[model samples]
Target chain A: MRLKATNIEHFYGHEKILHGIDLEIEPSKITAIIGESGSGKTTLLAILSSLLKPTNGDVYYDDISENSIKDINAFRRKNIGFVFQFHYLIEYLTLKENIALGAFDEHNINTLMENLGIGHLANRYSNEVSGGERQRAAIARALVNKPSFVFADEPTGNLDTKNAVGVFELFKSFNDTTFVVATHDKKIIDYADVIIEMEDGVVKCISKKRV
Target chain B: MITPLKALRKNWFKTLLIFISMTVSISAIFLISAISSGVVGMYSTMLKTDGDIIVTQKGIADTFFSDINRSLEPKIINLAGVKELNSMIFGASPVDNLPIVAIYGVSANRLDNYKLISGIYPKNDEVLVGEKIYKMLNSPKKIKISKQEFKVSGVFKSKIGFEDGGVVMGLNDASKIFHKNASMMLISLEDIEAKDMVEKINNLSDDIEAKTTDNFIDNYNQFKIIKTSSDIISALAFLMGILGIISMMSMVVNDRKVEFGVMRSVGLSSTAIISRLIAEAIIISLFAYIAAIALSYIVLEVIQNIQKFQGYINGEITPQLAILVFVISIIMAIFGSLLPAIWASRIDPMSLILGGSK
Candidate 1:
């Protein structure tokens, strides 16, 4: 699935957070949005993922505009997943239960848990595990729905270098799902197939890595 | 995924607070209902008699204050369907250490109603004391009413609540003490003639009214006042209980805003989240209702043992009342959680994530 955003602009009250922006997210690739603080990278990612509606433009999934979709929540449920910087796993639920929150189908859950290397910790609460383990569970939750695209905002912002690399490696292994990650970390450039840098609410450069 | 259950388990203290508030509210309603039912039961038992019709002064709030001419008894007994007639006086006075003791003045023929448990029937100025009053007065040999001394002839028992805690004497002595001709008259009519007999008796005088036993009980002003008061108090208690549940649910939703945001971002719709919240509230209310039933029973038992409420209140919980309370509990649950659930559904996932990031 291809995600396209054209002439996108956003405002928080009277302050404009994002200017007119246009981008196309190619299918099945790691597209990283890298920028310093307050550059509106997170805002743009939110717009493309259907978490927030842009003030001036619309996002499209394979030529179907968001405005045309009758139920946006249903569309996101069937096609999109999310990972936040804080790994917002419900504290009361077990890791397995947290992952099941996003699953529309249950047959693949066990297999996915085992592949994530946290199968033995499935019954442990999110607070009972380490930060890296919790984030891994969050990633498992994102992919459990078998969505076409996974939007992550600073998913590894709280992890160490080793854990951050491991997270990117996990993202790289899922070749069928497009990943759009917004972060300021330079390490993501090594694994990203496409990198878009933003400064002060506008795109500074778009660079594609040669195969 | 049992998220609501898991959340309740994790926050056991909050769950307990909500449970207790709901239980108290339900119990208040149940207790009021039980007491009202008990009072009605006592009245029903007291009014039960072999007589088919009762005659009393019209427009009186209490039968104790009713005053009918004693000469009407002879005319009523001579009526076509009249089999027998008994005149009686009812009054209340403080005796010994007791306040407001019921006093019944009965004719000699009405002695059949009292089951003599200890001694013989009363005569002239003598009196028969009820079992409860006997115990309360420590088997007194004689008592004083209106500065007149009367010997205690015996101790008797009756199913009637007022009779069980009262003093019974000869009708003439009661008339002298109360300074009245008669309070009321009881008429025993031939089979299937009560309706015609009541009308004939009512026509005998303009100041007196005659009614069959059932009609008399139905129109009793005291019973109506008790029932209406109980209903009003129960309604207020139910409202307060619902408000308590709403406040508790609002707190729960406020504390879980971020969790709801996470759920929404993961593709759970707003309706699904609201359903979960309502489900939780219902579960809590159901458990509270069960607890309230048990609590009401315990309270009733304790009250039944008190000397003042002995025969007057049986403290029975009827099936109809229980079912009514159960239905009210479910309604309370839904209404209490609706506002909070709607508030939770309107939360913006993006704002939560962004706010948390900062």
Candidate 2:
């Protein structure tokens, strides 16, 4: 396991969202987390992405300490990437600038855009583009920082079947890094190397398949 | 640093409003400065164009009412550092219908300083009248002076306190007509130092005091303090204007909360965001200030040159006023932009990325 969580507990105000959760994430592999609504799938993803703090226990990033909120935030910034259902592109900037924004280096933006098949949409404003194009742009933006792990929460939740398959296949063909995605769609299940089913914030079953 | 040009392009209307506020603040300051300069300019012209020194009776607060003792005239002339001096008899009094006209008695040499617009300077026993005084004379062509009628010298003007409407005559003629002692003396310096001249005059005469022409003219009109007070009041008004602009800028930043979050996520530091906003404000304000100064100067100059104001208002716009307005505008821009920029820098990129409201 490259990233590990041990006895992690999380809460929002007085209500408990995660209880002594323990999980291991492998390197250079695609991991899928499946759960029903309100099953803590998104919450766990947020905590794993360092966007939320655990109430107790600890999370480690490849042996680096992420036990504190500051450490977790720094780790998220330098080593982790995130994508969501909304795309959330900056409306004022063009697609290319938005994608390059994550890298903090304008020089590498064009190359990343070309590689992601978004070179033609580089100058298009976020609001002017279609949902599929914006999602692709978001993926490009996430990958631009060259993070070791990419976390997605319902990335294709709002997309049609064709775009969803295309997005899953894009992640499936990524050879350079690992991915942890949460979803309910059965269409994407075939591409996962490992699938964990979550119910009521607990992992009820796990399955593995050969690709 | 986030380039301000990009921010201004993104938020054009907000930038424009900031620029407008800056313009108003700076213009208000410049207006006050111009009025002050005009007052000072009027006093300077009076001193330079009228007399070098003014002598009035000691213990008398009003120059127009001071009366000299004739027995001290020769002693004054023999004093060290003594210069050319002429006694003047001028005052105001009630007549049958209204206040009597202002009057002055001058020697031949002092007559050259008066610019007669329509008539000549007073002859040996005749009197010349101020334009305003001439109007009050009520006669069509000539007016009576003591016992003889003198044709009104062309209606004239002087940088001195000619606004009070006065008449002038030879000192001897005025003393004979008014039937009183001389009121004051106007002095012209040749090579005598002002301090030594005043000291000698003070020693020679018992009830006489000498003052620099600048001070004399300043005391003549009552508007000097008003000019300075207006400047202070306008400066305070500009400060309030800057504060108002700052609040408006805060609203602009508040409206762009999500955008700031995106910027932070994209590797923009807080410093960069603040710098960008300040730069945008400065650019907009500088442009507006320069344009406003140019417009005001042209308008003021044209107004000063109009027929009715040719002698009364000397256009006093100077480069110093423009420079002052420009600098104030820049300062106001930075002050207005600072807080919002700081807030923009504080936005968390993570909250924005994770489906949280900025």
Candidate 3:
């Protein structure tokens, strides 16, 4: 479950969004991507999540390059999980159904919800919860599938300082779980086992702590 | 496979819209079919007025206007396939200020051929009138014909359009009012299986034509005009329905652009998204089918009961037609949402995550 993006380059129409970038995400280790607004941090995350394809290079899940993979969707569904800033929960389903969405039969959504402090909200509708609670619920849903890799884009971007710290702590508990978090929050820097900084769509700094 | 029922519950509004459009389109098709069937019903009613073949003057524009030579009966009766032959006269005569009243002169022996709904067949100069014409006159049960003051003898009911507006009396009594040999002949074959009865009768005499009741009406220019017109109208309705589906589906797909994008980012393939949308569309169309059938049945029933149209105006709704509409709506919905779903799936996930479209 190691994710490697090799010399990745991407553009939107004529303007380049992500320039030649290379990075390696360690298996079962928490990695943090930090950058300013237009530094392509989210673009790199999109590539790792297999939601976008880099124009010049390819993503590697362990030894297999994305191009050699016959079914990228099946790969993503079985191994990758995504947690966006907005917590895109389907409005029509109750919290329990949404959390249980992509999980295998062995996955326990009720246990995940309880661990995330969202057990009582299982029967509630998406709109009935507060923003922080909803974010927690989203995290619970992502983990319920027990994906090998989890991608988080600005997970605490919309939260207050207290809730922001709480969310970062939630990610820290997954130290033995592979997680690539994209954020501009200064408060989450201490929780990272590895920190990668992006500037103008290229990697600027890579700092790691021996695990 | 995602359950369509689940999707419907999640996206109730979109589902309802698809259902409504399908219902309207299906009902339009059914309405058109009912009107066309009404024509056929009227034709069948006309056939029930006689047993097999009807005869008229060869050169006459209409059977009611023909002058068949009464002496021809002997020649026709002795023909190989002939069993029994009877004659009748029909014409449009003025009734006071009323524009025209249809008058029919029949031999007493021929009265038994028709099913009278009410009253008895008129004898001598007395006459029987159609229920429709009789009701239109607002006469109090009894009415006078030709000032001879005959009782309202009988009211006959027939599916044929001709019987809808006419009065019947003895041929001798009618001859006194208007000169006529015989207008038409109602003939039944001695052998019901005779295939060449019409052909044989046609060869028996000049200035005379014989045909089965169904073929005779089908040959009418009036029936042809109506048939052609219904086909054209049905075609137009079908086209409009397709266009309607396309337009509405475009709006629906456009409205759900962000939703589809979200689905794609959640590891759903473009094909999966397309399939889900199509499934939703089909479920919606099914709802509409049920609605349209109910609405159409109520509508046709009201028309039949209120108007009392004797023909097949009260049409039958078949399950095949419902299934046809359901499948057609699904196809139309898939085509409509196809391009939109593809566009949504092709969206760069980075752009969406960056809150660019917001």
Q: Candidate 3 residues B1-358, lDDT tens each? A: 3555765666567656656766777777776666565655555565445558888899666655788888888988898777778787876665433456667777778877657888777777567777666666664355555555556778876545446556677887776666777888888787665448888888878889888876777685556676687667766655665666566656665665555556555566777776766666666666666777789888877765552342225465566655665665566566655665566556555556866473
Against the true structure, what is model 1's DockQ? Answer: 0.71
Q: What is the TM-score of each predicted model, taking all chains together?
A: 0.92, 0.73, 0.82
lDDT (10s digit) by residue, model 3, range A53-167: 7888989998689888887766776788888888877776678877665556524887888888888998898899988988898887677767888899999988998888888
DockQ of every candidate structure = 0.71, 0.27, 0.41
Best by TM-score: 1
lDDT of 2 at B258: 71
- Candidate 1, residues B257-356, lDDT tens digits: the string is 8888887888888898888888888888999999999999999888766786535565678999999999998888888888898888777789665965
As for lDDT, the candidate ahead, 1 or 3, is: 1
Give the range where candidate 1 chain A is weakest over 10 consecutive residues by summed lDDT. Answer: A101-110
lDDT, candidate 2, residue B340? 75
Candidate 3 TM-score versus the reference: 0.82
Rank by TM-score, descending?
A: 1, 3, 2
- Evaluated at residue B31, the lDDT of candidate 3 is 66
* Tens-digit per-residue lDDT, A54-154, candidate 2: 78877788766576435343455467777877788877778987786647456877877777677889999988988888998988887877788888888
- C-alpha local distance difference test of each model: 0.87, 0.70, 0.73
* Model 1 ranges off by over 4 Å: B48-52, B78-86, B158-160, B186-197, B308-314
